[model samples]
Target: MSVENKKLPQSYYVPAQSPWPIVGAIALFFIAVGSGLTIMQLNNSNVSGVFLLVIGLAILFVMLFSWFKDVITESNNGLYSTQMDVSFKQAMLWFIFSEVMFFLVFFGALFYTRNLSVPWLGGASNNVMTQQILWPDFQSFWPLLKTPAGDTTQAMGWQGLPLINTLILITSSVTLHIAENAMKVNNRRKLQTFIGLTVVLGGCFLTLQVQEYIHAYTELGLTLQSGVYGNTFYLLTGFHGLHVTLGLILLVIVYARILRGHFNDQQHFALQAGSWYWHFVDVVWLCLFFLVYVF
Candidate 1:
């Protein structure tokens, strides 16, 4: 190794205090409050909630762009040492782990409601009296499409758009893997092509998902107000859709980085992180496909 290379610090690079965190928190606060108010005002004529939601999202995008710009500048300037790279890797790992736990909570709720709570309400085990007195007409079902409150929604099937979206996401994962391998071999042309294809696949998946939501609401009468079935269905799938949107954004950023000649075969932590996240999103979709649709 060259002497200059050996001179690279073993300590991590800690950037000076930044306002991005606070800005991000403020953006999220607005998003949460605005979303709540917007949903509440859905039947009303007021548009203030929608305004705030847009402003919040705009601020969030600005914050993300500025933050990533700073990171990219530092990275290209070689401010990040080996230790810093390890720290970044660890941070990405933990972030993905936290996301897994976050989704697990919602999945756990679905499982509990399906296996225990609904069954109990429908007279399973020793709850015969409960069912007879409270919900005599309610039948325990995996989907619980017809709630005790009489609200009904058509169940989303696994075929058609859902299956197509599944194939798109799975294929995107494969493309991303190919992109990563191309990056490893320093084949920038193949890397850019594969990653660009992955981005297109992601966009297709999102388009299909939106179409599916429209079909659910317009054709099947499945909506957020359709009781437990609709609630769990939308919540789980909605959050996953948001994740896919974020993943698409990340992949786009990575694609831009590739175009700018940012990453090479040796040091491409940003690409690696983005690819890791994309893979995680793909895995989560597989789980959702099976649990929410098939099972």
Candidate 2:
């Protein structure tokens, strides 16, 4: 490659037009509508929501496959330059930032429920009827044990399974970082070893997480309908687990590409993006460990 080809003006930046975005948007629309209808059908017992949700997810998977294929084709064709690398970096940064905001929304809601809503219901401020008429035994506290409806559950502590998962995720993040740095330095053996270790560690964390959930549900009698404690606990951890699953999938794709001799030392944006995503998932798990498990 010529040095001139390595650098290009921003004005020359042009990506091929693709229809995947529109298709993805349509799929999401179906998902939103289907979920709404499904919730509304809770009492009537209709099944349209299930059908729509499945179709929407299938469309989404198709869109992802098509879009990723196009990208890989472009990369293999040598159509991308250093400017494209910069664009990928910027795009990944913005994507992670958006995800940070997504988690922040949920965390904010958790905080609001714990600090505001619970107190108001317990008559901490003005309304004495909050205690006199409703919830006479309601006690406002973090890692809420009881819901306003009187359902109770034991809070998940930070000492056992959660702490182990936290350590596992953190170690995976470190190994992934080592793999990324190895890639940058063209240490292919080290890169493979680190990435493989990272993948194994991630799998371990997920396995432990499932065990924890089982212990919570079966051993501790904690369940989704147990109360707000169970609700928030599941919501936060479940969302984080979904992200971890996605990160694992991305890592697997990168590993396959590596085996195929696809990415080079300097041109491994997909690998870097996957690493960033994995690390982001790890950090989110840390926050969840502190807030959800540790209190």
Candidate 3:
């Protein structure tokens, strides 16, 4: 074969060892410890736990900023190849799968508590003697607003703010899809407009969620201390809210990249990943609405 006709072996780019992973791990450790302490100190009027939490979050944010900056620079420099793109896509898929399992555990807990545990406690399946001895007045209901311990809380209904938030999320997902379509057609104006709308919708959803929480705590007498119902409600919805916040951050980053002429129709894995995550968040909210609010 002629020298000019010889095929060159493809080279894979390997990034140098970096400190960001360790820094991120340390930040997570601080966040976990700080959050635990904060929860423990809820009634003690201690501010140290809050201080730690803030520090941890600040460090985390810095780590993310630096990490993403490095990634963007590398991409802009044409460092990534087709293999790297495939690797990123696979990583994002696995990440989303892990998130699905993470939520499945909580949903499983909700199901078990509702279908089996509560029923057993209420004298189902020949446990009459058990119920009689344990608590004769305890009732087995779906919401279980009135706990066996005599703590009562109103259940959050699906008619008002939650419904509105659900619609907003669904609409945001649609808007993001439209943005993706616009990206495919190389219509920067349409892409930016749709994504901007999606971001606004996300912000509105979060605002309404905060208002809903305020209503629950102040007006509805619902709180973490209310009982198992309250515990499940807050944990599920609160975690979902955190996911929504993360999705919003990702969308904002994608929007900034779009403004900077970062992505093209054929190579926009970051935008695709962000869209997948946003869709996942929307689906989770739908489940939460049906399970927690409606039935």
The prediction achieving the highest lDDT against the true structure is 3
Q: What is residue 125's positional error in candidate 2, in angstroms? A: 2.7
**Model 1 residue 287 CA deviation in Å:** 0.6
**How do the residues 1-295 of candidate 3 rate in per-residue lDDT, one tens digit apiece?**
9999998766577999988999999888888889888877878999888888888888998998899889988989999988899899999999999999999999999999999988988999999888899988878888989876787889999999999999999999999999999999899999999999999999999999999999999999898888899989999999999899989988999999999888988999989999999999999999999998999
Residue-wise C-alpha lDDT for candidate 2, range 1-295, written one tens digit per residue: 9987795565434676889999999989988888778756856778999789888878987997788888888889888878788888999999999999999999998999888888887788896697778777776777666666666678677899888888889889889989898898888888889899988988898899899999998877688767777878888898899789879978987887777878877689999899989989988998988888777
The segments of candidate 2 whose C-alpha lies over 4 angstroms from its true place after superposition are 1-13, 29-53
Candidate 1, residue 219: how far the Cα is off, in Å: 0.5
TM-score of each: 0.95, 0.85, 0.96
Alpha-carbon shift of residue 185 in model 2 (angstroms): 1.9
Tell me the RMSD of model 3 versus the true structure: 1.5
Rank by lDDT, highest first.
3, 1, 2
lDDT of 2: 0.84
Which model, 2 or 3, shows the larger TM-score? 3
Error of 3 at 136 (Å): 2.2
